[model samples]
Target: MPEVPQPVNDNTIKVRQLSHYQFSWVAGEPGQNGTYTLQLVLDQGAWEEVLTLTADDADALQDLLVNTSVVHYDVERRTLLFGVTPAGE
Candidate 1:
């Protein structure tokens, strides 16, 4: 499923996976100081983000989700970058 942009107020945000390939990314609110999280996913199926930034840094996010077929996702953001292809034939 496509990753939805989660919220980060104090420290971190939890990425909810809607499918097998739910790639996620995140950054601080626009002009909201500066704090960023490093996104990583493993084969073991684990997603986590850490607060390694302050409210003074600008951080944008980008993710690549590989789905089994056509995964559906809904996010507050209107636009996003997705790299996908048809599932196995």
Candidate 2:
């Protein structure tokens, strides 16, 4: 029998700081979808996470990053704040 797949959970990680990032693109076979991988090193290199996004999604994120003036990874909120000024203005 084939091995069963495990269920995925909706968990969130608080990011205090990001130390590094890398982007990669893999071409899919004929008639297949390619994927973009965004590798992130968080918490001053304490850990890392890789996110796979579709081409459209990756383009959208790139646009946002290009146009945004500020980006914040709020640890307490556990979310990304784009185009919002950081504290202590």
Candidate 3:
């Protein structure tokens, strides 16, 4: 058996929401802006804007953020460990 690669400090990660159960965007950078439009694709599907950052710098909609549908993720890790599960039981 193997252990999951847990986030050493998930708190550092920041996410901007767009709507409830709709679209939520996470970014490695800080703050929201017109250039920060989150291009997200849930389950590796089509890409869509989770949060519309335009005009003045504003945060993403809290209701629009979705974590379960993390279609894509660019994680930054210092030391990561990989593993594999048994093919057959």
Candidate 4:
């Protein structure tokens, strides 16, 4: 007999795992009023503009997600960097 998978809770639904991810900060054009856009790429295919971060927001986010696999950003140039921390860190 095969055991069926169970949901953790009524509101919890299991879905496909994200195999890979990428993040980047795009600088707004000259007249865009100094706004920055954070973009995310999933599984090397799908694309999503997750959020827009202000200068202060980006700084705070960098500190919060320091333990994650990859983190890269330049405050001056507004360039986004990406890297993956090895497994079992």
- TM-score leader: 2
In candidate 1, stretches whose alpha carbon ends up further than 4 angstroms from where it belongs are 1-32, 45-81, 87-89
- lDDT digits (tens) for residues 1-89 of candidate 3: 88756664444433322122233334545564324444444223422234455423233232223323222232333211122234795
Regions more than 4 Å wrong, model 2: 1-13, 67-79, 87-89
Error of 4 at 85 (Å): 15
- Report the C-alpha lDDT of model 1 over 8-70, residue by residue, as the tens digit: 432342223333322223554887644444333322344332324332322233223332333
Clashes of each: 7, 0, 13, 0
- Could you tell me how far off, in angstroms, the CA of residue 81 lies in candidate 2 after the best superposition? 3.2
Candidate 2 local lDDT, 1-89, one digit each (tens): 98745552223444445556677899899999888987766666665667788888678877866676555465555455576655898
> Which 10 residues in a row give candidate 2 its minimum summed lDDT?
8-17
- Backbone clash total for model 4 is 0
By TM-score, how accurate is candidate 4?
A: 0.36
The per-residue C-alpha lDDT of model 2 at residue 73 equals 61
TM-scores for the candidates = 0.21, 0.58, 0.21, 0.36
Query: Candidate 4 residues 1-89, lDDT tens each?
Result: 97756755422322222234334566568867566544544234332225577878766656645545654443334444445456899
RMSD (CA, angstroms), candidate 4: 9.9
Sorted on TM-score, highest at the top, how do the candidates line up? Answer: 2, 4, 3, 1
| Winner by lDDT between candidate 4 and candidate 2 | 2
